[model samples]
Structure formats: C-alpha cells, structure tokens
Target chain A: SQQGEEDPQALSIQEGENATMNCSYKTSINNLQWYRQNSGRGLVHLILIRSNEREKHSGRLRVTLDTSKKSSSLLITASRAADTASYFCAVGTSYGKLTFGQGTILTVHP
Target chain B: GAGVSQSPSNKVTEKGKDVELRCDPISGHTALYWYRQSLGQGLEFLIYFQGNSAPDKSGLPSDRFSAERTGGSVSTLTIQRTQQEDSAVYLCASSQGFGGAEKLFFGSGTQLSVL
Candidate 1:
C-alpha cells in the first residue's frame, strides 16, 4: 500500500535555481525518507528525517517534516542538470517496511 | 556484496508462464524489501523481511505472487501464471537492520515484461 503522496507531479526548472518538492502521507510514521531515481534505474537514498526532527540537511538537499500536518518537503539548492530525476518520499513503518509516494519528476534544464 | 544486486536486468515472458526474480542484498543487512513499480506509477509494496522474523506479506496483490529469502540474504520473488498487469520493474532494497529508520540501499531492479 502507498501512504505518501508527492505534490507537483512534475517540475521544470533551470540550473542554479532552487527546486522544492512536497509530500503528504496518511497515518503516523517513525520517520520519512527521500530517494532519487535516475531514468528507470535504482533509487539512491538522499536523506531521512525522523518524526522528532523538524528539518535536516545534506549537501544540497534540505528536508522538513511536520507531523502535525502529516507532510514533508524536499528542497534542492542550486539545481543542476544532473539532478534531473524522479524524487520519491517514503514513510517508514515497523519491521523494515516503507510506504512510498507517487513521486515528483524534477527536470533541470541546463 | 557492496550493494544490492539483482539478476537478469530484463526479462520478458508470456502470459500464463511463471517467472522468478532474484535479489542479493548487501551483506550484514538484515532487512530486505521488494517493491513493484508500474509505468508512471508509484512503487507498490510487495513484501519485507526483517532478520530472523517472519516476513510481512500483507501487501501482496494476489495469490500468484510469492517470495522467499534464503539464509537471511538472497531473496527470490516468483510470479505464477503471469499477466500483463504484472509487467513492471521489481526493485529490491536492504537496510542495516529492522525498524532502524535506516537508509535503504536499492538494486538496479529487474524489468519484467509479461506479454
């Protein structure tokens, strides 16, 4: 079953611009994680924010979680053409299970 | 393994036939997961295994689908009497342990096409 739902199904932006994507899920979670998939290949783990954490950052990525609203957002600073890919948000559950979202396709034009 | 690995990057089978996909997760990772992704659709959870615990198979769509993880490492996903709807990419992932909120390392996945 899918719990997370990413908003802005698709986004197109130019290089150097900051791209932001959002995700919403139903029900409680232990943590929320973000991944990147290039073309149709495997997903690369980007970042993870625990339920207690309001925000976290790694490299050019920033993730914010709000348990009250059941929503999370991912921001990419200085978007690059190489960053063109589909971003997914997953809600972590017990026993190593994770419910994923439909994902947001970000296209960074060089 | 350095990373999660999947076999037969691509497989095409006819309807009514059975197909098996394999995944070799990173060593020492006790958490394994299988997910299906249809074209232009979000990942659909299939099953998950945590260490020595019994697997969680609640997300399986039908009886035709089943999976097994041997030796707490290599995992296999089998589909019986395949259908066109089963055509999708099967992804495998593994984490350090169960319920750690740890990151998942994903395999390239097997592109299964049922004709």
Candidate 2:
C-alpha cells in the first residue's frame, strides 16, 4: 500500500503562474518531503516539512503540512519552463524510511 | 563532494539472466536506499541500509531480489532470473544520517531492461 498519494495526475500552466500540488497520507509521519524529477532522471530534493512544522519555504517553493488531516501541499511560485517536471511527495516515518507517492506532472509553458 | 553514484547507467539483459547494480554513496553518509520506477509511474521502494544493517527488508518484492552494503559505503542490488516485468529504472540514494527529515542525495540511476 502507498502511504502518500498526490492529487491531479498532471497540471499545465503558463509562465509566471503559480502551481500547487497536494498530497495525502495514511499514517503518522515524522516529515513530508517534496521532490522533482526530470524526465528519465533521478529526483532532486525540494522542500521538507517536519511533523512539528505547519509551513516552510525555500526560494519559490512553499510547503505546508497539516498533521491533523494527514495532508501536505507544495506551491511553486512564478512557474517557469525550467520547472517542468514530475513532482512527488514522500512520507518519512520515525523508523527512517520514506514511502513515495505516484507523483503529479507539472508542465510550465515558456 | 561527489553525490551518490550508480554504475552501468543502462543495462539490457535476457529474462532468465541475473543482473547486478552497484551504488557508491557520498563519503560519510550512513544511510542508503534503493527504489524502482516503471515508465509513467512513481517510485517503488526496494530496500534500505543503515551502515550495513537493514532493519527493513519488507519492501523487497521477492526472494529473487536482494541487496547488500559493504564497509558502510558501497552497496549492490542483485536480481536473479529476471522477468520482463523487471524493466524499469533503478535509483539509489544516500543521506548523512538515519531517520528524521534529512534531505537525501540521489544518483542518476540505472535504466534496466529485461528482454
């Protein structure tokens, strides 16, 4: 069973627009992380929001965690063509391993 | 410092043959992980190691799949009698420590195809 599941399998937007993706999980998590993957490549770590943190930000990426709902959201501000990629959310447990979601594909038009 | 590195960027093998994939983690990292991603799909957890000890082998699919880390640095994943369904990209990652919310460094991954 997958611990995390992202909504909206794909998203497309124009340049300068903001893109948002949501992830929901089943069990308790120590942290939730977002990752970006270019086509046929390894994933790049984006932002990690700890269980105790309600929100966090890095550059244009903002993450919010809602432990009460077991959900998280990733918002990319000013989307760019370079931001076109697959975004995945992973849940990290106290045990130290992470379980990833199916991912949401985001395409930013140049 | 170099990031995690994986070997044989690409591999194509016969269905009945055995294949080996190797990973060299960043120096000083204590945790290593393996994952598989199929075309148009998300990553599936395979195995994880914490300084040569795997407290979790539950992610491994079957007896035909196995992995080992040596000297707490390099690790290898082996698949025996591969099947066509085994075709996918194998990714490796490493982190500075175990557990919590530390960011992980990843390798480009090996594209494996079992014909």
Candidate 3:
C-alpha cells in the first residue's frame, strides 16, 4: 500500500502564478520530503519538512506539514517555466526509508 | 564531487532474459538505494544498503529482483527472467547516512525496455 498520495494528478498554470500540491499519508512519520523529476530523468530533492516543523521555506518553495492530519502541502511561488516538472511527496518513517506518493504534474506556461 | 552515476543509460532486452544494472555512488556516501519508476507511476523503492549492515530487501517486488552493494560504494541490481512488466526506469540514489533525513543524491537512471 502507498503511504502517501498526492491530489490533482496534473496541473497547468501561467508564469508568475502560484502552484499548490497536497499530499496525505497514513501512519506516523518523522519527516516529509518533496522531489522534482524532469522528463525521463532521476528525481532531484527539493525540500524536506520534519514532523516537528509546521512549515519550511526554500527559495520560492514553501512546505507545510500537519502531523495531526497526516498531510503536507508544497507551494511554489511565482511559478516559472523552468518549474515545469513532476512533484512528489515522500514520507520518512522514524526508522529510515521513504514511502513516496504518485506525484503531481505541474506545467508552467510562459 | 561526482554525483551518483548509473551505467547503460538505457537498455532494451527480450523477455525471459536477465539484465544487470549498475550504480556508483558519490565517494564517502555510506548508504545506497534502488528504485523503479514506471510510466505514470511514482518511484518505488526496491532495495537499500547501509555500510556493513545487512541490506533491507523488504521492498523488492519479487524473487526475480535482487540487488547488492559492494564495499559500501557501488551497487548492482539484477533481474532474472524478466517480464514485460519489468520495463521501467531503474534509478539509484546515495546518501551520506542511512534513513530519510539525509539528503539523497540520484543518478540519471537506466531506462529498461523489455520486449
């Protein structure tokens, strides 16, 4: 069974707009991470938010974790054409290892 | 420093054949992982190795899939008697330590096509 699942399988937005992706998971977690993958390529780590953290920010990426709800959200501010890619949310258990969600495809139009 | 590297960026093999995929992690990394990504599917964990400890083989989908890490630096994933369902991109990642807190560095991955 998948631990995490993202909503809105595909999304399209104009440049300078904001994009939001949500992930919900079952079971407790130690941390949740977001990763980006280009077409037919490996995933690149984006940001990680620990369970103890309510929110985190990196550049234009903002992540929020709600342990009480077992959910997380990734918000990309001022989306650019370069931000077009697949975004995935992964849950990290206390013991280690990650369980990933299906992912959301974001297309930023110029 | 070089990033995690995978060999044979792409492979096309016949069903029932065996294929070996290799991964060389960044120097000094003590943990390695293998994952499979199918079209429209999320990354699936296959196996994990950390230092001299035993590998976590729980994620392997079936007996036909196996992986091993040598000298805690490089790792290899082998699939025997492959089936059409085995066609997917095999990705390898390495981290400085075990568990999810450590940032993982990924390789471009080997796209496997089974005919």
Report the alpha-carbon TM-score of model 3 versus the true structure.
0.97
The DockQ leader among the candidates is 2
Candidate 1 per-residue C-alpha lDDT over B4-111 given as tens digits, one digit per residue, 9 for 90 to 100: 999989999999999999999999999999999998788898998998899999889999999999999999999999999999999999998664379999999999
Q: For residues B2-111, what per-residue lDDT tens digits would candidate 3 score against the true structure? A: 89999989999999999999999999998888999998899898887878988889889999999988887889999999999999999998888766777788999999
For candidate 2, state the interface root-mean-square deviation in angstroms to 1 decimal: 1.2
In model 1, which regions exceed 4 Å deviation? none
- TM-score of each model, paired residue for residue: 0.97, 0.97, 0.97
lDDT of 2 by residue, A1-110 (tens): 53689988999999999999999998989899999999867999998899999999999999999999999999999999999999999999888888899999999999
Tens-place lDDT digits, model 1, residues A61-97: 9999999999999999999999999999999965457
What range of 10 consecutive residues in model 2 chain A has the weakest lDDT sum?
A1-10
Q: Chain B of candidate 1 versus the native chain B: what TM-score?
A: 0.97
In each prediction, how many residue pairs overlap at the backbone (N, C-alpha, C within less than 3 A)? 0, 0, 0
What docking grade does candidate 1 earn? Answer: medium
Q: What is candidate 1's CA lDDT for residue A58? A: 97
Model 1 chain A poorest 10 in a row by lDDT: A93-102
